[model samples]
Target chain A: MPFWLDAVRRFERAIGVPVERFVTSDAYFDLLPHLKRAQSQLEDAVAAMTEEWYRLVNLPSGSDVRQMREQLSRMERQIERLTKQLADRDATGPTPTVRKRDQNG
Target chain B: MWPLLGSDLAGRVGRDLERSLWRARNGLRYVQAMSRPREGATPKDVVWKRDRAELWRYRSETPIRYAPPVVIVHSLVSRSYILDLRPGSSHVEYLLAQGFDVFMLDWGIPDERDADNSFETYVDEYMPLAVDAALAVSGAHEVTLSGYCLGGVFGILYAASYSEPPVRNLVLLATPIDFSQMGPMVAAVASGRLDTAELLDETGNVPPDALYTGFYMQAPTKEIAQYATLLENLWNDEFVDAYQAMAQWSRDHVPLPGAATRQIVDDLIRRNVLASGRWELGGREIDFGDVQANVLNAVAVKDNVVPLAVTEPVMQLVGEPSKRDELRLTGGHVTFGAGSHAFKHTLPALSRWLADHSDELDSPKER
Candidate 1:
């Protein structure tokens, strides 16, 4: 119903799917590298990775696999962020609004 | 007036004028394809074997290993020799001189049985098989896959999907990626206003006249109206050669498999699949990331079948930096390939890009 949703919906309609409402899938770890880039929210990256992968493969409409992949990515990103925040609190009582990934890996 | 516009009077006058122009283009093509080689008109020989998939090879006389061999895969709608027309204007000759091996996959005209053949047959079966044969002959682990127009689209799709394709670089010339922007030719085929199945039922392969009429209808100004004017300008010999060659080539067309046409319209034009990055071929997924090789997305600034807006989307789809690059310049779709600008610029761009990025290429056979 929103304009952004409508734009994405138009794209999905052209793509012949319900990507807008579909939940993410379990193949989330495949996007680990991409998720590292988006510090704040995993939903956006998960959504992108799912929709694009589907188009590339030319899968038919309503692919449960693609949805599962997105759902996993979002959850992984969220958990990864929570772990980082908790570690950051232990290192210092209060943190600055700006956050960064620990790049030891 | 209908006859004046559609009558034999108009056709006769139009044909005569076009005959001259096709002659000039063909002459230029002959000179381009053959005149060099230092040996005169003797064509570089191939073993010439006929397989389920029709293919021909033109090894350069003075062979050089600049890149892996170049495999030319053209549209299902035409003959392969269009690229190797004569000597001067041949695309194969030019690539051979540039120090690359060349092979062409010719989808020979189909008959009644071919009507059942689908796009999957070509992408899943014909093209991949051709690549295997070329790799076996060239002994090169990777290649520069160059495809023209619709052939380019198929080439891009194939290169993207196949795992570790024996391709060093992917070249897409005047290939359409976003069919939504295509002119009336595709739109008619897409909207179901033109029933592909019914037409295929009536005729095994879609007729050449039907294809030409659709293409010409898009630019009647160039196809008919311009010829009406060119009758006065026919004195030039160059004009005569190019006109005759092009006219002959235009009328001579290969039929598209009915099933193949159906898939293309449904998946590409109607559904707008490829650009969306969800296109599936041969069971495996086809993400741009899968094609880690260098890509040269060369688009003609003025093409009708594959407009710049459409053909250019491949650049956006691929990975960054050394992975992909684009050349957005002048020339109509097919003309950019054979004419003067091609030699002056496009060939060099292809050569330089391949040479510079040759290191990033994976030669699976090398190990």
Candidate 2:
């Protein structure tokens, strides 16, 4: 072991205990929500400004790309569902349709 | 007295000079990112894949002693490499050496396309198929479903929802069952102070940065402390390599799918359904009592991520008392898979329980 290693370990412990307590404290948790809200608002504002700039320049924005992606994703999901249904039908065979005259008889 | 003082001074100076030289050399390597350790280095093959999910079956030179194959389900929010972190420190490596057939179910990083994937998508669609693929490849009648963190929640839900799931044994590592006991970050979401919808970006997934921030808030100064420890241990090459590997894994996070995030926020966090036994999925009520597999819940005593309070209650909720067991070990959350704690305590105890429950093969299968 190095000569300074012991001193460094002691210093770390001295600094670590108090910081751990402060972070785990109720006061810190109470302040967290406000910080998160501010961050979210800042992000939203920046995105909105960027979108506005894109519109003024006659260019597509991130939201436009996102919309297209969402449409594609929806189509993919529909195809998956249809494929699953077909597989299930194939496995169990097709259901027989009831005739009105046969039902009445 | 003067002569003794001079000798002591000389010794101290020499040690200080040596320390400085080691620090300089190691610091350069760290900065240049040279000789960084490789993670997930174990040899494995993808037995099955659907969308972004993959089932990896690890290869072994030795024949298997256990009958049923063990499949590991990793957490959604993080990468799966933590289990196979390094050569000697890997959990999967230990299991393979113990002569057990091992497989890993990894949920790859989600993008916009996976935004609409709900719990139903994973439980009903992906998990069953992954298990079937493992069974098909291994020619095993049943498998031991082992899950870590949120993966354990998925396993519990899957086993409980299905009438006769082909799971012979279930192992949970640092899994949180009682969400009410989870810390303030979860409480903020449950209390509606933080809107989960607002957290989703244009990509239709919760960004990795946001998830990292949540984890960071739990212990703001821990990273600084870890750096200090790293500096102290920088003189040792082995210590530095291990530290670098763990540090990289800690910072690496994956985006959570939008629909699954919403469902978890509403059903698991806010309602606390699993703890209360009121959870339902796919038009069926999920009852832990319905899980017929033998259960093992491993809780880390020093884990702040998933405290004992949150993880210990699963013993009462799942399976019969005779079939359920708990292994309470002294270490942090990642200790079950990595570090000396895993090799010394976790792997041995876990393997003993698994071997007791598993049927022995008549003869070892050749590679």
Each prediction's TM-score versus the true structure: 0.63, 0.86
Write model 2 residue lDDT over A1-105, tens digit each, in one string: 556766665676688778767766666767766887788788778978999999999999877887888787777767767876787568553221211111112
Taking the tens digit of each residue's C-alpha lDDT, what string does model 1 give over B1-367?
A: 6766678777888887787776566546655743332221216544233223565667555546455767777887755655665467666777666555667776666654456566666666567656766776666666678887778777766766654566678877777778888765566557665565544423355766667655554434333333433343444556545554555565676677777787787888899887786566555556655565678888888775678888878887753456778877676765544566666776667667656755333422221
Model 1 iRMSD vs. native: 25.5
Q: Report the lDDT tens digits of candidate 2 across residue range B1-367.
A: 9999999999999987887788888888876764443448689999888778999999889799997999999999988999998788889999999889999999988877788889888887788888888888899878999999999988887777665688899999998888888887788778886688778976688999988887876766666657777888777788887887787787788999999999889988899887875467876677787677999999999998899999988999987688899999998999878889889998999999889989889998864
lDDT per model, in order?
0.61, 0.82
Query: Evaluated with DockQ, which candidate comes out highest?
Result: 2
Task: Quote the chain B TM-score of every prediction.
Answer: 0.79, 0.93
lDDT for B26 in candidate 2 is: 84
